[model samples]
Target: MLFIKRFLDQVDEKPHLSAVADQLREITYEQLCSRARRAARVIAKISSEVMIGVAVNKSADYVVSVLAVHLLGRTVVPLDSHCPISRLKQMITSVDLSLCLVSRCQEDKLTDMLQASIRLIYIEDAIGEEDANDNAESTRSVEEEAPAYVVFTSGTTGKPKPVLMPYRALNTLIDGMAKATEPRGTTLLYASQGFDVSFQEIYATLCYGDRLLIVTDAQKKDLYALTEQLSKERVTRLFLPTSMLIPFVTFSLYEGVTLFDLSEVIVAGEQLKVTPIVRRWFKSHSRCRLINHYGPSETHVVMTCQLDNEPDDWPDLPPIGQLIAGSDAWLLDERLQPVATGCSGQLYISGRSLALGYYGMPELTSKSFITHPLTQERMYNTGDICVLNERAQYEYKGRHDRQYKVRGYRVELREVEVAVLASGLVDDCLVVASQLGLTTSLILYFTAPERGQDFSLSLHSHLAATLPEYMLPSFYRGIADIPLNQNGKIDTAKLPQVGGVRPRLSSNYVEPQGQLETLVCELAAECFGLDRIGANDNFMEAGANSFTLISMLAELRHVLGHSFRQTDLFEFPTPRLLCGNVQRSKEAPESKNSIASDTKRKLRSAAIHNTHGRMRGRHA
Candidate 1:
């Protein structure tokens, strides 16, 4: 509430300042506050101090709706407009949400999908229907102890538990960010609406009285679109998932640009690793300033490790450096006793940045959230394995639990294992997890009665229904038996590695012949961090998302000299199919050339110019 009050103060003082802008339009602080006031009139009619779902995408409407909820002293539950209908229904049911601010375009879908009892207020129409002068403010005081927001997890562990983040904690994060970065110019609101990072984006920008550039849903993952928007918006502050930072920078470099000339790139949402390429890139681009962070959703950010100064002596995974001010952390062993410096132990964070525990999970909360021995401040066991080096800097080891991050989403190995077992296909399964460079992947190793290409295909199809793409295993390998040590426990060391299986993605095997075909195969292997991937392997089946494709496409453009659209990969995922398409696309113009070479070259130049013009127009 304090943060909202501060943001509102900015809205009142700097009425003409740029508040938020998207592809279609921009809004001043006055317009944004006015719209939020109008929205508050409608929202207050529902119920005060109740949870309200804002089922919208990355837009000004979402910003307005969240503010409206805060203005009414209600909690905002962000339901991504593009989320699966099943996930949406589950969240709505779990939270007992009866009212949702739905975009006009998404009304029919919500009406059809949701129960008749639940009401969907069309935010687009509601924004303008009520007068800004209406006195519909709730009587809730700013001193009220209520949650600011509840961000839902990816449900990879089991079900998505809502992480209750209080207003004071939220306020503290933004206040800290303002001091940490002294943010100026526009900040990009680029993450998913439901993500906790988006919380940082919205509040950090507005609370600090800075501008926010909202990227459209379509432009979110498309590197070409994002780069253009970044350059056009002149974004000076940006935060990206570790998964996306490298690839985006790679794409920007290929286009002869850094992500931004004067931007502070804070890479979080997952473990930040400094590869040789990332190290070299940061050093070469002197203007690039980066703040690498590591923490769980429960703890917003525990440390700020400077990434721009990645020394040649940097390890594969650098230490998640010094703690944030006012944060007291402990490296504890299993007994919760302090471990010696330079010894690996689970990290327990006691700080203002800790969340107010998981919503509706008191037992679980009591277990993880404990009182500090030295300081009685409520502390959270991060379940993250870390170590305090002799230099007094904390370094990340890995997660103590089986949990891992997939594209910035928290995923538990047990969750995937449970889903795999529920299929009634495999009795015993061991998910072999690995990370290559910055990409994290899983390989399902199971013991089946009969093993062949059909086994993997069936399991893949079964998983597609229950698990999200990021949670699915990239490779399916059948083992003769579950490896066990003398203690009768599964020995990961004894299990067969992925490449040794000598299995094709599908029954139909197609070997690479040409240079382009071979290049596609290599890209697939590298992108997915696979030791062996056939030309017939589907990228999606191999856990390759758009982020992977962005990096892959950048390389292809450099090597093949053919600029291809991102959509081309979805249809032709296999290397054979993609290679064919690229070849045909390349030869199409030359094969059917009715115009001269000079005219074609001129047309190409004009086309590029027009594209840039359109990109500029979008941000206008």
Candidate 2:
């Protein structure tokens, strides 16, 4: 509440200053406040404390809608517009939401998914354009414990649970951020709106009378474009999840450039594991301060670990660092008693930054958020196993429930992912323990290297050399990119299931005819460790996974004196068809990027196209 009041005060002082910007245009502080006030008049008519959804999108109007809803003391629900239609419906039903605010870009799909009983107000439509018939609301005292925002996160029982955070928590967070960052500059709101850090970014930007820039959906998918935008805008601060940070840094290094204006880089949503690339980034970049921030959705940001210094300050486990203002961390054993230094315990956070509790789930709320034994203050059980060091700093060990027994020895999947990242070949990796009857298989999913580069074999070799046999994953799947949730965390639910039926090739063969076809055959045969030379050999059956296919294409480009895309393998798996495409690529060097886009076109021309199905031999 204090932060909100102070933010408005700043806005009043600098009414003409640029407040927020998207990809297209910018809005001044005066327009933002005037629209928020008009929208507040409309929102005041709604019943008090009713849940209202603010669709997570990159629009200035969405920001205005959020501030307007807060003015009426109604709880704002940050919904992921990209969530499954069915899940969105279920959430609407659970929360009894009758109204939701959305941007024009998201209106069509959401309206189609939503029931007629629900109302969708376009953000621009909510505010009065000409200031006509304004129904101003009377001033009232705000309650200290009233819920301000409810963020839904995945629970252990496979359900989306909503956590209600009070206004005090947000105010404390904004105050902390105002104190931590520089007094004035632009801050990027690039993470999903549902993410707690996004709230920090929005309010903190306003508190400093600074500019707020929302990253468009297109820029988020492309690292080069995003960096260019950030540099172009001269954004001084950015908060990215660790998953996105590594790739952006890697692409920056590959391009041999550095951002001159960015002053700080804050990474969270995953463990800050030190890698060779991380060391190199620190060594090379001296202007930007690298910070490792840690907090659950329940506690707002609490701890920070500075990573500017290199190897000597880093250990196997990165410290979550010192506590934030008005926050306290305790290391307690299973019995809720203090543990000795260096001993592992469940970390509990007690502070004004705590969320009120889970909405509509009283039992869950009571179970997780409990009273501290000594202080009698409410505390949240983080479910994270942490160890206190001699310096009184807390280090994140892993999740309490992330441990699994493999061959009678405990394995931490975080350790596995950390090791994989430390190898310097992979950027983001996920290790899942898939059950197969009585035994569990540790399956590793990783993103392949950039086009025209090969690293899967080297990654496998590195894992073997580093870890014991029991700790190693049985099946390694290299994907083009790692799937991420709306929160920018790994989407575990979307990972490929293990132990599925493996496709087989039929008993058919078509020998290579053309020179390009023969060369492709040899490359595929050598890359997959197979001796068979046929035009219709099933790539999957020949032990060629996605990672090997990229390498195969890279090798093909080198030998043929032309560039072939990684996607060309999937579109034209048959040697004859792929060879024909390669010859065209050689002839049309100017259209290299478009050469990959012609995948479906080439597939349509083929007599038989198996876009995803296995290519059979002559006989079944």
Question: What would the per-residue lDDT of candidate 1 be over residues 477-559, giving only the tens digit for each residue?
Answer: 77778889999987888877663233455535567786557666765655565554567877766656556777887756544
Candidate 2's C-alpha runs over 4 A off are 46-49, 115-117, 132-140, 179-183, 308-317, 402-586, 592-620
* Tens-digit lDDT track of model 2 for 295-373: 7777878888776456445664478788878899888988888888778999999988898888788999899898888
Q: Residue 214: error of model 2 in Å?
A: 1.3
Candidate whose lDDT is highest: 1
Q: In the order shown, what is each candidate's alpha-carbon RMSD?
A: 6.4, 13.0
Q: Which ten residues in a row are the worst by lDDT in model 1? A: 611-620
CA lDDT, every prediction? 0.73, 0.68
For every model shown, what is its TM-score relative to the native structure?
A: 0.88, 0.70
